[model samples]
Target: MTQAQPSATPEFRRVAQRLRDDVTGGVYAPGQRLPAAAELAERLGTNRSVTERAVRLAAAEGLLTTRKGSGAFVARILKRIPRRAAALLGVPEGSEADGTREAVEAELRDMGLASRYFPTMSTERAPQDLAGLLGVKRSGKNVLVWETRVFAVPIGAQPTDPGTPVELIRTYLPLDIAAGTTLEQTDVTPLDIRGRLAELGHRPTEFTETIEVRPPLDDEAQFLGLDTDNRVVQLTHSTTAGDRTVEISVSVFPAHLWSFSYRWTAS
Candidate 1:
């Protein structure tokens, strides 16, 4: 890709993109030594400082890693595996492996965001629809559940930066299983929770999603690092199993610094 002329976008950003494209376009093969810093600066028609900043940004984005004494080299790229090997092994970042969870957390940390999940309960009656999602009998007693906190951060580490506060999340599961099961053991997602329940003989065949935008609650402000004046984007998802709906979950996100995306294509 050709580099763009510098304007509002930083000179370093343009330099970074050029370097990225060089590696991606095969000009700098995997494991190859990049041009020396001075040489890269000359080639890009910029100074050493701009080139250095670009290299650092690329490294932070996982495109490159630096070595002491030795100059920067192209990061190694593994060869494509055969179909059978690919089927048995998945890389979490690009493949279906469990490592994806850590990858997500790493991305969050890189952006300086914080997250916390806790187990709590709701004494309030499950709404008719939510009760169906959890698969619990409507007439049953009030039950315990899972509550969580999630925070969004800006590009920098400072806490005073503007951010939205959200109520974050609330999840409920059946108490039919022995009481006091550790939260870790019982904290399956709505989709997977039904499967766990089914393993013990329950089936959830229905699910629902409700999304809204609203002001954050007081508790949400404390956990999400939000000012009392901020509002949040809320998503409430419910799932049902058998005659009883067995799971209810709500996820909240700050409005100012959040992004949401989804796409579907022919399978």
Candidate 2:
């Protein structure tokens, strides 16, 4: 296809990048079946084994999916969605326009894809590691944990994918601020937690987030419909009010399905 690449790059990696880039570059559409292995190898000036390895490599990164009977196809998922860094100087009254992350559903709708949220709630204590991150004391009846699976469909998708979730949101909150509230029992959203916390006099003055990428855990892999080999983006977020940390959330995004963007403003 393109001109020869640097030989320093492994042949397989170069082939893999070309396959991934071609998908993103629209040479192959999402859910579109790729040409046969022989054809692909011929186009790339390689043999079938190298082409197969490249496909597997790209699939592990979530760029494509392979079927036993059917051929490899570009992943039947949203390949591009902006995951902007959040800036929460203060919780806005009625909207999240204060530079904080916008809702995923809104982002999908803007991109013209239908989306849904499936949530599960729980009452629990923060683990030692998470307790340290949240800066919350573990003693007493004070931890609330919940997770939501966000599902969205790409336009003109195929039967291979239906109601598949691209991301999972898990959150932890100190019960002291939300002790006797709906958030304690019902499925709640990140923004909803922010609004409720602000109502209880815990408006955020600063937010902190860190990202890591690795292979998905067993359950995470199954729940998000990803192959165990796929890379996943883990986002750890915290909201602080003055000196108090009221909320912490970790979002798991399948790397094959989404990409993130960051913005900075001079203060």
Candidate 3:
């Protein structure tokens, strides 16, 4: 039998969309306090609870901010220019697998933009999708998951306000390849995983990347400072040595902050 379709849209989603339209159309100015929950409910002819939930949804999208004992206010949005970056379809001659990140940083530096990499590493069972990518069974096998956030360096800003985050990256490595190595460490490292893998005699001989466009998840939206109406570019990197898949990384870039290009030559 065919699977049934999911349920209809929630009432809060409808309310949220209406509010988003108003905000985009300038009905609500940035930094202006939004109407009270009861007032909004009355205006939309909906219950107060539904209106509150809708406000929360808009807040999650970075379009509104709600203050305790006060009320919701429209957010002052910033427009960030998209930076151009290339994703090579194949490994360029004389280039190592680990050079991509460094290249990106160098390009930004040339444009008077600095970058910092913040990484968090943890040991966990490989998710089913990641297991398949790593050519392993989905039997709750433990693996090393590394999450990294790339942020622009503010010239004279304090650490509390570092700069805008440019991208979010997550890498998965099989236990056999990660155990007893720095890759499994919780501390952030300047060395790339390819360098660590080379030390372990598993240098990848091939690399492939797949790119997709999709809307961000709630957490991703918050991390990238994106609204619900915004989208992101998701790229997957797969590196292999002979028959073994050594690493798989997924990166998410806010659509407004990244522009990708590549050249192709016919055989």
Candidate 4:
């Protein structure tokens, strides 16, 4: 049974529960489109807003899918990705067992899934929290940003399958640190960012990471083919060598598709 959700009204909950029951009871088969908005509203005896709210909640639960122009449908259950074991996502970035961003790509490849990465570079004014984390003043500090999206193409699917986006990565580097390196070049992506930092005398010896559950940001949700009702796993990873922090990365993954396990020692 689904518990009452935060900020959801009694009528909204009632409608959502009915929809969930209908789907589970086989009244609506998997991958089947739901009735029109007016039909659903009339059936539920509620406004279209209430029906939409219910659909959103169901989508978050992984029982329904809401697509633009196509409307909501019963979600077709797919094989689930196993939980990921992590140490700095544990033990820092890159190494296979550490569950670095690359580890996920590796896993997908092993499972016969193919992906293409689209990368872009730009600069953005540092927000207060991130600015402080980078040891810079938000008032004037700007960071070089690299955003990469990994789109998953299904086996034997057409180029225009509109392959799903499985991962979104954003890396931030201080301007002074990136001034003369490949990090500043949008077209030349470094296979190992930490490795490059080492050549500049900044070998990362320690890293800090934080993981939390939350709703996806608007753009994030859209890219991940999700709605506001979905929960997403967000990780903020920072690396440092001795006294200076060298790099920071923020990664977002679909909560339904990824799980993270962390291990650490007590100080």
Candidate 5:
């Protein structure tokens, strides 16, 4: 990989920064072969391990591409998104309609990405981590945890363009229904979740959300119809009743294709 001289920072950090700057600055032109690790270490006056770590970090940040035997090369710079286009995911002022999930899903089908649902917590089989999240022992009582993945036709060959399908998930419950059945059916929506909780004699008091940006996991990529190399945006949400946490969910959006946008202004 292209090597850069270390700065005053820590050895590994300095080396990583220099490499990032060089790649981003186009000094190491896209697709250009970088020096081999050992040669790069020699050029940077660092050890091989340090050089390797720096290169790995750069690769993870989408700055460099590494081929199995061909070695590493500068990654092509992605086109810079204009502010207007980047705002597509955001909900404009008063533009969101209540009870729009079905409509949205239909549109997604038109785009070629279809949506599917699975439970995070299930009556038949529940993962151990999910058991803990539900505040039960590994083999304790089960609860409903719903997950949904949406797939859309690519705007292009690469999974990094507008109109890509991603997944939005909600892991709430049917309240006191004794969770024997998984909600595999597509008929459930936010209102359905509320209705089920109500039928169980529980109130859907409040819902909260936490947003984050991160890369997609392997399964996430598969569900979103993306390559494993694609990045995703993640948002975690939870619902509660009377100060008790009842449900949690994580939604993943393909970074190059979809984004989440919400707008608020001074009232």
Candidate 6:
């Protein structure tokens, strides 16, 4: 009787796992080119198609990267877990004005990493949804939109490879509140939005964040250097000072490079 053929699923997984082990165990160094699919199949005793699937699976896991016209190569995985920053949420009590941003930069500095910020400001009418959230009539009154790009510098990196683009932040505030205030500046503010609002007699009382996971848009993918298979974490932040919504911000972070943690009393 003919022997039953082994299922391709298990074979594929086995090949992928073996390659993953090799990569993780330093058999293949970071940025090192992986064996060709045909060669890998011959060595692993699997067919070329199964080996190719295995490589693709590894790439999806962020363990490898495939370039068009070039074969798969090991990815340079950042091993350190990034420090959690509440900047996306708001400033904390007893912290300095721009404490949120400072805190994040400090943490990166501590880890021998560097950071750069690019800030831009513009005046635009609030979108329908944002206007509703801010309790403003959709009558085309302009709002201040401030965008900042946060980049993380790798240690010993050259100017040509200065750093990795980490996060994109966009903050929105009603024009009446932002006009004539530091919030309208195109430069980094000495304080965060909430702090600046407090300076204007608006005491920030609460903030609510809504987080969603979805595929990255084309622009986001390009800016973050994310592979086509990767997704991103998009967060919408709303801060209220008593009865008024003082600020609304949206931040996008690469899923592979960030995580969030929260602490609260069990009251």
The model with the greatest lDDT is 2
The residue-by-residue lDDT of candidate 5 on 12-112, one tens digit each, is 88788878887888778866899999998887778898888788777665567677798888754322211111112233222212223455555554554
Better of 3 and 6 by lDDT: 6
Model 3 residue runs over 4 Å out of place are 1-98, 186-191, 264-267
Candidate 4 lDDT, 1-267, residue by residue in tens: 998665387788799899888888898886799998889889888888888888878888777888889999886543344445445423333332254556656766666666677888877776567777776657654787888886776567687766666678888887778777877766644246776676677767777878889999999988887877788888877887778777788888888766566555565
lDDT score at residue 142, model 6, on the 0-100 scale: 66
Off by over 4 Å in 6: 1-8, 28-47, 70-73, 80-111, 139-141, 189-191
Mind giving the per-residue lDDT tens digits that candidate 2 earns over 1-267?
Answer: 687644335887778788778877889887899999999999887888888888877777777877779988887664477666554454464333354445555677687676666778777778777886666677754578878887787555564657557788888887666668867756576657777777777777777788999889998988876776788899888777778777888899888678777666668
Candidates' C-alpha lDDT? 0.54, 0.75, 0.72, 0.73, 0.55, 0.73
TM-score for each of the candidates: 0.44, 0.76, 0.65, 0.71, 0.47, 0.77
TM-score, candidate number 1:
0.44
81-181 per-residue lDDT for model 3 (tens digits): 33333444455433445366766676676656677789988877887777877876676657788889888864554777656677898888898778888
- Model 5 residue runs over 4 Å out of place are 1-121, 124-133, 153-165, 168-191, 265-267
Best by TM-score: 6
Write down the worst ten-residue block by lDDT for model 1. 79-88
Q: How many steric clashes between backbone atoms does each model show?
A: 11, 0, 0, 5, 9, 0
RMSD of each: 13.4, 5.1, 7.1, 5.3, 9.3, 4.8
What TM-score does candidate 6 get on C-alpha atoms?
0.77
Model 3 gets an lDDT of 0.72
TM-score winner between 5 and 6, please give it. 6
Task: Please state the error at residue 239 of candidate 5 in Å.
Answer: 1.1
Candidate 6 local lDDT, residue 79: 44
Score residue 18 of candidate 2 by CA lDDT. Answer: 82
